[model samples]
Target: MKPHVVAAASLLLIALAATTAGAVTFNATDAASGTAGGQRFDQAVGLAYASQVLSNASTFIWSAFNQTSPADRKPVDAVTLVVADVGGAPAFASGDVITLSAPYVGNYSGDVKTEVTGVLYHEMAHVWQWDGQGQANGGLIEGIADFVRLKAGYAPGHWVKPGQGDRWDQGYDVTAWFLDYCDLLRPGFVAQLNAKMKDGYSDDFFAQILGKSVQQLWQDYKAKYE
Candidate 1:
């Protein structure tokens, strides 16, 4: 081959590599920089640390979902985190953006950085995980996010123990524990469930994956601990 042609091919390869590596970009902003909570965030969880967590959480979520290739994952080009004086929940995810409550950060009495990291992980899971195209159970969606947080080893001390929830889809920690039980029954069950949820959700998904209804599985899980 000609030298110029070889050089052009090399440049093309480099460009492709850069594109692949830059598929997902993370950004963080201290929107509530003037607030006490915002100051706490700056001291304990700066924009750089938050951005890093976003990247790390994305990588972890991909692996947890068994999405080995770009084709298998959601096409999210960017994820942005904003620390602001928000009310209600400590943090929430909307589309690809995550907003952390400044008040929550300021008032938290424990390791704020670690707590924020866990929150980011849960929110990042929402950014990546499919929601049965908006047809899945709300509790299951939240549970899956918490499940990802649980698998990442950041589950908080206050979270409920396995088999303690009133139902399988009670949401948050309760649902997360149940999902963990389901995953144990069939290794990679969570990943499989997430993949199936890409298009839609059905109660029968539990039966299809584990040959048992979700209710029955919940009963069995409770029995083990009871």
Candidate 2:
């Protein structure tokens, strides 16, 4: 979305490199097709819309992460969405696959379409994010995904406001809000951090990019809102 931060080619190059014409195969299935949530997903969300959202979220995530080159992103050939009869979290992403809980979808209040789109945005980020080859903190990885959701303008209402969390790496929306602040301080802060995390992660990365430890940055971030 920040077209001014980088060239249009950077935006176009990486996304188009994921595969042939950036053609990511998307498949969806409802295992609990008889349940209320399954019905909700079918009637409200549907497979076609979910597939489109997947593609769009892919582009948004690439742009949001500042992955302007083929080397900057994961080479994903396909992704799948399965609606299952499960409980707890609404959805989760593993490898190149995503699963949404039918019960959660059935019971959710408010705008179902908008909410699911946000969920898809968050989960899809996991499909493409590096995760330091499984060496990074799980929480930070999740936070980065939420950072993508936030950047896509799909953040939910219940999330903590800016500077309101107990720590910078608290994960989910807390770390997401913190990362958003860091991105403001140094444009492409998340992207640079992610790039550094391709091999591994270090608390020192905060120091490297922002000239201060993450703890110090958190203090400043918290103080700004006081």
Candidate 3:
């Protein structure tokens, strides 16, 4: 058995002690355990911490989305994290599984734990969020995930400043900032928008929820920063 299995078992024990009902199970595994990057992850950000972050990020996402009850959220019962020797992106989520690149964690010069936490929060949002049944704008989906990360106070310094994207749905930090602006105009706008997306996405969602087209909102957001 790998070291992460022990950590995962410990977390399960803690969860069982805390709740007997409706608790989501979280697991973390290091597929690249013998690699240098994987060793760095085990030392700097152990499987225990990674598992805890997964659980924490899920709760934070639920609150961010105003998913007060199971009925208001996705039907995911478990989430898993895999640390491996991947490339390109730092991490990506497929269904309930999140893959974190061990190389990214090892090569990070600043704070790996904090950076990994932010990435986990963003990926966790993907695990719980609706994707408009594959009809939603890809950028919007990514933006919502980053929006959750932003709300959780985990946004990295490298992200674009508020109101700096070319378009509202350009994605990532850009769309997150735009969504933040909309939420300010009407509190819980992101949550409402997410609920609407349970079925499908529409640019008109902005007009329906905030009484203005998305383009106008983008212009207003840009004007504020300019």
Candidate 4:
């Protein structure tokens, strides 16, 4: 009878040990159990997203520039996107990390998955994209990111006609839409433009593809769309 009780206890202890081993581990230093703007995502999915972002960013980098080989690629490491509590803030890019303050990840009945993924893809582009020696137009910088997301087929349903803004590099959805037009009007226009940006962006790069200045191209785009 004593032997039977000891064996049962040993089995229970083993089961508990196995369960503990299977639990997910995180190195969160600031995560609270119940915070106003905190949530947990699938550990595996989050990691996969990070991997995809890096891979795609690498592709964009290599293709967007004249880098002869992987050795010539820019130094990019450790891209992180965080979900935090920020009220009514549109997405913004920071160095190496972009924090998205969501009202709630799953509360929205809309296309939350596409929306989130699209935004992440856009920001990830910014992380890997070169800003043309800090001389690139801010609007164009944003447009390029959106162009990649659009190409990836994650574009949201709300994008409308391009060239509606007062200027060409309006950024975000505005520039994204215009880029789509450029892709249609001039095949591989965005890809070549991306490569130019990778090496130090210049407006003259537009003339290489379109035979006109970026301002002229913007005017043409506006005339066509509007």
| Cα RMSD (angstroms) for every candidate in the order listed | 9.4, 11.1, 4.4, 9.3
Off by over 4 Å in 3: 1-21
- TM-score preference between candidates 1 and 2, better one: 1
lDDT of every model, 2 decimals: 0.89, 0.85, 0.88, 0.61
| lDDT computed for candidate 4 | 0.61
TM-scores of the candidates are: 0.90, 0.88, 0.90, 0.69
Positional deviation of residue 136's Cα in model 3 after best superposition, in angstroms: 0.8
Colliding residue pairs in candidate 1: none
Report the lDDT tens digits of candidate 2 across residue range 1-111.
577656765534322312212666776667676899988988898877887788888888888878876677888888878889999888998898899999999999989
Candidate 1 vs. true structure, TM-score = 0.90
| Candidate 2 clash pair list | none
lDDT, model 3, position 97: 86
Candidate 4 — which residues are off by over 4 angstroms?
1-33, 40-68, 88-90, 104-109
Q: What is the Cα-based lDDT of residue 102 in candidate 3?
A: 89
Best by lDDT: 1
Give one digit per residue, the lDDT tens place, for model 3 in 1-226: 6899999986564332111124788878888777888889888988888888888888788888899899888888888788889988999999988999989988998888899999999999999998888889889999999999999999999999996979888999999999999999999999999999999988999999999999999999999999
